[model samples]
Target: MAKHSKKSTNLWSTPAAQVLRATDDTRVEEIDFSLTPGFDGTKADAQELLAERGQVLSALQEKLYANGRSGDLRSILLVLQGMDTAGKGGMVRHVIGLVDPQGVDLASFGVPTKEEREHHYLWRIRNELPGGGKIGVFDRSHYEDVLVVAVHDLVPRQVWEPRFDEINAFEKELVDEGTLVVKVALFVSPEEQRTRLQERLDRPDKYWKYNPGDVTERGFLPQYRLAYQRILDRTNTDYAPWHVIPADRKWYSRLAVTELLIDALERLDLDWPAADFDVEVEKQRLANS
Candidate 1:
C-alpha cells in the first residue's frame, strides 16, 4: 500500500477549493458542491445544469408570488460583486430573468452622486433595502467600502478597515429582521477577463460597456485581489456567507447562482397566509343588496 500525503488527500477528497481557484479558470470546469446535481462548466452537461437551475428558479418565483398575495412579506437581498468582465450583469440577466418582475427589484450602484457622497457610506444602500415580500438585487453593493475605496485610497485606511465589522453587523440585523441576505462574489481569472474585455472592445454595440478606466483598473488587479480576499475572510459569516462563484463560464455562474438562490428561498419556509372572514356581515349585506 502506498501512503498518501495529508495535503493531497484533502485536496482530492474534499469540496473545499476544488470548485474554486485563487487565480485560474481551471476550477470553472469542476462541479460546484454548493449546488445540487453538481455540474461542471467544462462538461457537455452544462446545458442540463442550466435547465435544472431554471426549474428551481421557476418554483421559487411561484412561491414568492403566492406569498405576496397572502401578504407574507418575505424580503430577500442578493448582492453581486466582482471585478470588470466577471459576468455580474450576465449572471443577473440569466438567473433572475424568470422571476416575477413585480416581486423583484434590481439596483446597480455606480459612482455615487454628489448628494449621495454627502451622507455616510451605507446611506445609499440602506435606502435600497427590499420592502416586505420582494427580492432586491444589488449588482455591486456596499462591499465597495472595501473594494473601490480601498483601491483608490478614497478613505483613510482605518475607516475602511473597520467597515468589515460594520458590514457584518449590518447584515446580521437584516437577517434577524426576517430578511434573507445572499452575497455572491464572482471570481474570474485575469486571462479570461482580458479575453472578455477585448471582445467588448471589438464589438461596436458593446463598446459602451468598455471603459478606458477599466484598463487602468486592470493594472491594479493584485491589489483588488488582496482587498477581495480580506473582504471574504472578514465578512463571511453564517448570517450572510459569501458564495464565491467561478465566473469564467457565464452559463455555469448563472446556474450556480440560481441553485444557491433556490436553496435560500426554500429555507425560508414561506407560506400563503390564511384569509379572515366576516360571514354574518357579508350575508346580511348580500341580502340587503
Candidate 2:
C-alpha cells in the first residue's frame, strides 16, 4: 500500500493522516473517542500549533539524522497501539519528545522476556529495528502480538490465527526493506479510559504512572473492543497503514502525532547531505587555521 504522496504543506484540513485512516470502512463502533477529526484547533490552539511545529520537527529530524550518516537507507517505524489510559506514555513524552534524542529509537514492548518467550514473536521485534536514518518508537507494538495475544487466550486460536498473515508479511518486509511503517491506534474512550485511570489514582505525581494492571485491564473492555476490531480488520495494510488516533484529546493526540510526524518527514524529500570530502578543499583547510 505504498501510495502516500501528499505533502504540499499541511497541518490538517484532512491530514491527520488522512483523517485517522484505518480503512476497509473502519468502524470500531463508529469511533468518536472524543471526536476531533481533522482538528479545529484549541487546547490553546493545539499548544500553539505544537510550538509552531517544533522548528519544522527539529529540522526534519536533523535531515533524517544527516541522511543516515550519509549511507541513507531510510527509516521510520512509529507503531504505538493503545488501551490502558491510552496516551502511550503521553505519546512518548509529547510526540517523541520532539526528535533528535539522537535520531530517536524508543522501543517499549513489555512482558515477554525469557529470551522473549523463546524467540519468534518477531524475535523481540527484530531486535528493536530502526537503523539507517532512525526514528523507531513502538511503545506497545508487534500489535501486542495480536492484541494481547487475542485478548487473553494468550495464544491458541491456531496460534493467534496465523498472526494476521504473519503481520502482513512482516509489514511487507518492512516496506520492502526501507522501513517507514507508522501504525498508531490510541483511540481511548471508556469515558477517556475512566478519566485516565482516575488521573492515575489522583496524582501523587501520577503515582509512578499507576498500573494495578490498569485496573485489571478495565474488565476487558468488551474484550478490548473485539480485539481492536480485529486489529483494524486484519492488519489494515497498504504497505503498513493504520492511523486511528482520537485519543480523547490529549491536545489532539499530541497535535495529531505532530502532524503524523510532519507528514512523515515531508515525504522524505530530504536533502542537505552533499559534501563527500572537498567542499572547496574543506574551505581551504579551514581557511588556514
Candidate 3:
C-alpha cells in the first residue's frame, strides 16, 4: 500500500482520482455514493461532460491501438463490479462504445456453464484477457468468486477467502506484463436500486433486462455488503486501485468512468509508434503514384 501523492487539481471537483480511489483508510460504508460532488447544472451539462470524456477516451484508445501496431506491447483492463442495475451495461455502451470495438475485449461473466464449472474460477477469465496494445473489460469478472459466492456461501469460507491474495497476484502479473488494471465498484443506494429494478419491470422495452433472480439477490445485501467490504479492504493495492463510483446518478457514473479511464490512459504517457519503413520513401512513392 504505497502512498499516492496528494494532487490538488480538481478535474470535476474533488479531483478525479483522489476521492474516488479506495485506499486503506477509505470507508466504503461512509461514502455517500449518491452525492454529486460537482456539476450542479441540469441533465444537459452531464451529457456535455459525457461527450467530452468520450472524445478524450477515443483519442487515447487510438494511441494505444497505434502503439500496439508499432509493437509497443502494452494494454489496460477495466474490472467493473456492482449490484444489479448498477449500470455496468451503460458504462460499456457509453465509454467503450466510443473506442474501436476491435481493440476492446469485453468479458461478461455469468453463471458458469457445466463445462466451465469443471475448471478453476479464473480459467475462463484468463482466456479472455486482452493481448498487448488492446483494452479489456471484465464485467462482473472473477470478483464473483469472492463477492457473490462469499455472500451465498456457495463455497466454503476457506475456499473463497484465499482468493483475495490470488486476485492480487493475478493483477500484479498483468501489471508486470504491461497491462494496467483499473477496478471499479459502482455503488448504488438500496432505494435507487429498487427504483431502477422497478423501471425494468415497468417498461416493455426494458423487459429483456429484467431478471427474476435479482429480487432474490436483493434480500442478501447484508451478506453482499460484507463481501464487498472485504474486496476493497484486501485488494485495493497500489498496482490495481478500486474506484467506488456513485451509480445513483447514471449520468455521473458514465461520465466519471470515461474520465477516470482517460486519466489512466494519459498517465501511460503513450506516443505515436515510429514508422516501421522509411517514411520519406513511402511519402515519395505515394506522391509519384
Best by TM-score: 3
lDDT of 2 by residue, 1-289 (tens): 1222233134356778788888898888778889888776568877877767766777788888999999998888888888877888888888788777999988899989898898889888889999989988988978788888888988888988888899899889988988888888887778778887788789899889887988898888888888888988888988888888878889888888877887887887788798889889889999998
Residue 251 lDDT in model 3?
83
In candidate 3 the C-alpha lDDT for residue 249 amounts to 89
Candidate 2 lands at a TM-score of 0.36
Candidate 3 root-mean-square deviation in Å: 4.1
| Backbone clash pairs in model 3 (N, Cα, C under 3 Å; residues 3+ apart or in different chains), count | 1
Q: Give me the displacement of residue 158 in model 2, in angstroms.
A: 15
Q: Backbone clashes in each candidate structure, one number apiece?
A: 0, 2, 1
lDDT of 3 by residue, 28-113 (tens): 67778787654454466768767766766888888898898778878999999999999999989988898999789899999999
Q: After aligning candidate 1 to the native by TM-score, how far in Å is the CA of 209 from where it should be? A: 1.2
Residue-wise C-alpha lDDT for candidate 1, range 1-289, written one tens digit per residue: 1123343233223232223222322222243423422342343455554565576566676677677667666788989998888888887777788687887878989999999899988999999998777788999999987899998899989889999999999999899888899888887777788888899989999999998888899898878877887887778786787777767777667766766677677778765555566878989999999
Give the winner by TM-score: 1 or 2.
1
lDDT of all the models against the reference?
0.74, 0.83, 0.84
Candidate 2 error regions (>4 Å): 1-44, 58-60, 67-77, 83-119, 123-128, 137-140, 150-187, 191-219, 222-246, 256-275, 282-289
